[model samples]
Target: LGSVLLLLALYVLQGVPLGLAGSVPLILQSRSASYTEQAFFSLVFWPFSLKLLWAPLVDAVYVRRFGRRKSWLVPTQYVLGLFMIGLSRRVDALLGDGQGRGPDVVALTATFFLFEFLAATQDIAVDGWALTMLSRENVGYASTCNSVGQTAGYFLGNVLFLALESPSFCNKYLRFQPQPRGIVTLSDFLFFWGAVFLITTTLVALLKKENKELTPTKEETKGITDTYKLLFSIIKMPAVLTFCLLILTAKVGFSAADAVTGLKLVEEGVPKEHLALLAVPMVPVQIILPLIISKYTAGPQPLNTFYKAMPFRLLFGLEFAFLVWWTPKVKHEGGFPVYYYVVVLLSYALHQVTLYSMYVAIMAFNAKVSDPLIGGTYMTLLNTVSNLGGNWPSTVALWLVDPLTVKECVGAQEQACGTAAAAELCTKAGGSCVTTLDGYYVESVVCVILGFAWWFLFGPKLKKLQDEGQSSWKCKRTN
Candidate 1:
């Protein structure tokens, strides 16, 4: 019970940084261009994809006296706390709050990129630790802890923060007298979490002792160079290479809906705070679904659950596009009718089901297939491929939004507002850039079509890979 709770705490801390980074897009949607916001997200998330490069080092190089996991975890958390505190002092200025100047996109990217790098390092340590932290029979619970803890932390950082940060939301629900700003500012939140990180790290360092019995013998423990070689050998296997290709391409179909839908809804006039709040109902859902999904994924054919969930998720993309189209119609002078919220909540709930189903299935599959000899490096490699699959496509979708959109300047300047600069010029010239077509819808259609195509081409391969004997994925170590 204590180990589970500790693992949960570490994962929650890991998740908060991700939640904070994810919230930046919502905060900047009104202030920054879509492409710029996407670029920032792309850079911040690069660390997760690239962290696999250092996973072998993280797995192999540690002070035996200090504890392998704690050697990395303790220092990484300390650095993370200090980094957050330093960033809190300058974040407001960097975001251009109350300033006429636009956000410093490059600077924000660099800062958060480092922030995520620290978090990713922490993730590698914790993931490796989880394998040893539990009894073999109970090791499966690590996925549950990860899903629940991370979801809870993300809720606190994104949804709850957004709601509390909105003056209107606070005034409507939580306050007797309205203030000009929400109760918590981003800086205050950052500073508070930074303190939490420091305190938590101190407690863990003082109280928690890693089980030395789990440590491999001197002869069994691979050096950093040997660990990397093992990683490369694992990748060279035909089955493993095929799996990596599948992981890299599987998310292409869901990218537009997953990355752009919420932003598009915000663009279409759903308040960001309200949109954040919409996720509130899913908190419990996110926590519970993983436990339930784990049962199905524990079978020999874990990818079967993932394969079945894919089409439903793809279908939700179209549903989200429809919701974006319908939002304006439901929106009124004051606010949306109650039924609009119901529809959205119901739709989103269904989407969450499919999303979590796929997520848990893939994670379980990763855990099942990972080579125990280099557990951290192997699992991180698979996770990196999966994350890259989602990241690159989302980045591409965001980049293409402006280009695929069709608009015209109507009124004083009657011209095609094909670019953001043209649209800005149109607004300055007393003309409005009227959208003849929304890029989101077009992208959604293209993504769904591509998703189905992928399923047709690669669906059988996924099943076959899952059915392959475990020995096929094992590294063939040569002395």
Candidate 2:
């Protein structure tokens, strides 16, 4: 059990490295004033969403002669570690394309894509392994633990490394170059990515081994197509569709909040060091939230448990509030990093806990939706579609920010008028006593709410456990 947790921890940790690597471009795009440069810069993260396209193959194939979860998992983990190491080695070269605009985005994406493929493959194997390892009594614990691992990695991986790009610090460190404005652009650093690939590859080869399963006989391996068959079955189910939609909608408002706050902090001179320290709370939230969820679901109050997890009404209400009010009132005059950070911290902690409630609800919903025979396939398909949905909105959000020259128009203004309210500065900036990245938040909230409504109204809901359409009964997300 300990080894499984550790291996899974390693596996989940890969996401952060990958997410952080991806975040570099997002940081550059959000902060850099040039729309064209950011557009080119954004190209490096393109492969993240595209990853789900190949998720099926990752499920079906293994490196070992026999087919088992760890066979493929072992190899994939090392590849990701090496990919990060390589990027680290080339950190200087990888960043700061300046206005030159990365001509090498394709190559960079190619390498990032390589890293993502292995990382995704490992994700599949680990998820598969997790199911095999859990008993019904312990499944919630296992899922929650798994969530903890993935979520922990997500926060740590991104925050620890993403802070490296702090403009003030990078501005100083990057002075060595002809146009050293930032540390790494990602697009221009493909050659060095090989190091990450090499390191991650070596780690996997060193650490993992297959524990279960068998080599298929010639007849069993004849079609060698567990992937295609499973995929086909998943699409046939209506429950899978609803589940996927729910996952996509779960944290959109939360995501918008995060995007807005990050911009606000950087604008207010909340140094990365301060931001880094302030961010400590998020780590515990990720670790603890999932466990809270697992424990909540383990009890006997089925509907109550489901409601706490679903909180659909609460989530929607928050979306409306975020869109029309909450974010628009951001105050930064006193410059209380403690206050500002606390608001964000509390907001995210609630967000994390509530969101995992949805995950618990999702698992329940999927189980209620389908039986075991097609259940695995159904879940995988839902995960794939939900992941894809995440991309659609995320890309739209990122793309919107890029072209609008958000940091210049918004970031600078935000920096300038954080607490001018009832003071000369506030009157100087014109309208309110204070100004904020509220506009950005408002824009994102509106988009997310609209999307949520569309999905809520037009997207399918659970009527019957297996019902497919309008005839289905109205309901909640139990899993």
Best by TM-score: 1
lDDT of 1 by residue, 1-479 (tens): 89999999999999899889888887777565466466556668788788888877787778989998999999999999999998999998887864557777788888899999999999889988997898788899997888778887887888888888888899899999988999998899999999999999999999999988986566337787887787789889999899989888989999899889888877777778998888877777877888899999999889999989999999998999999999999989988888998999999899989998998898999999998875566787787788888888888888888778888899864655877677788888889988889888899999999999999899889878988888998888898
Q: Write the per-residue lDDT of candidate 2 for residues 30-143, one digit (tens) a residue.
A: 444322343344444445445545655665555554346656665666556555666655544444445554334445456555666666666666666665555445556655
lDDT of 1 at 149: 80
lDDT of each: 0.86, 0.50
Model 2 steric clash total: 26
* TM-score attained by model 1: 0.91
RMSD of each: 2.6, 8.8
Model 2 lDDT, full chain set:
0.50
User: How well does candidate 2 match the true structure in TM-score terms?
Assistant: 0.64
> Model 1: which residue pairs collide?
none
- TM-scores vs. true structure, each candidate: 0.91, 0.64
Candidate 2 ranges beyond 4 A from true positions: 29-56, 62-82, 97-111, 128-145, 162-209, 212-226, 238-255, 258-261, 272-277, 291-336, 402-442, 448-452, 455-479
